[model samples]
Target: MALPSAVKVFLLTMNRSLGHVRQVEARPLPPRNELQQSVLVKTFEELFAELRQKAAERPEGSGTVAALDKGVHFIGKKVVEEAAESWMAAEHEGRERTAEEISQLLYQAQCLMIASGLDLEDVYRHL
Candidate 1:
């Protein structure tokens, strides 16, 4: 099945942030029976790479670009907002909702990292 428009946009934004010149196309999910055998997952390393590229390119109309343009303070506020939402979702929402909120939180946090000129290695060292 084709991805929903929202998902497509999200993927497109992600690809653009990664400095991909080509358009992103939605791919069908693996069959349910094969899910346990193989699943596609994007790692945090990939996300950091994308954020680094976004910091450099600053593409117009991209959320990552907007966040980066706003600088670290604004991005830090968003990170806090997403974190609060994630906590609330975990406390009061369903698993999927909680996951979604957490994903948002992570994205914002990554944006903050980019704004601050930090990378995965820096974070890993701190951790």
Candidate 2:
């Protein structure tokens, strides 16, 4: 089965920080299912690689590949839009709804990362 897009998003965003979040008993992703740390680690790594491979394909004409090809400003607009939606969700709803919005925001950020040609490693190096 294909993984959910949100799972793929984490592969880009995950850093060493999550482990600390867990250990500290801080709720990193509230309203998320109680996904085991191991499951999250395994699935996210596999799915993230898959997304990167798809991006490398650079499909022509339409869809996500085409949207990304339109360049930075287009991608930036999407990121901004997603961010606003997420903020509104967090303010108005309970944890579950907020989680969904956050997922959308992360997925948009992943799109921007793909458009920038920056893999997770590039992000790590930058940080």
Candidate 3:
């Protein structure tokens, strides 16, 4: 399946950040509308690499698209809310509950990034 250009650039850029590749600047981002097929991902890190490409590439007027159209502040609020919930879950909940809460937090984080024209590589670079 084709990863949206945003995701690919994020991954390539992140790889460079880990010194697994050359500098991020040398690996240019593709145009926003570009699309390219990705290799089958087989690990959690690979799978964890980015937002689900399908979700990122969902059609206009789809529920995700509609929510995203609400703007970054809206998504940012959800990200904030989810982050708090994740923290609560980690402190007060069991493993499964924590996992569930983190999944939600992660999704909202992705929404925030997407809405802001950011991506997973942005998160990694901050580390």
Best-fitting candidate, scored by lDDT: 1
lDDT of each residue in 1-127, candidate 3, tens digit only: 5665665553343344456644332345454345233432233344334445535676665656666778888888888888888878866887788877877777677666777777667778998
On TM-score, the leading prediction is 1
Full-model lDDT, candidate 3: 0.64
Q: Residue 52 deviation, candidate 3, in Å?
A: 7.2
Ranking by lDDT: 1, 2, 3
Model 1: lowest-lDDT 10 consecutive positions: 9-18
Clashing pairs in 1: none
Kindly report which residue stretches of model 1 are placed more than 4 angstroms away from their true locations once superposed.
Answer: 1-40
| Ten residues in sequence with the least summed lDDT for candidate 2 | 21-30
Error of 2 at 42 (Å): 8.2
Estimate the TM-score of every prediction.
0.67, 0.59, 0.53
Candidate 2 residue 80 Cα shift, in angstroms, is 0.6
Q: What is the lDDT of candidate 2?
A: 0.65
Clashes of each: 0, 0, 0
Q: Tens digits of per-residue lDDT for model 2 on 1-127?
A: 4545554433232236454322222224433355554345324345456656667786565466766778778988988988888877866887788877877666667777877877777777876
Clash pairs, candidate 3, are: none
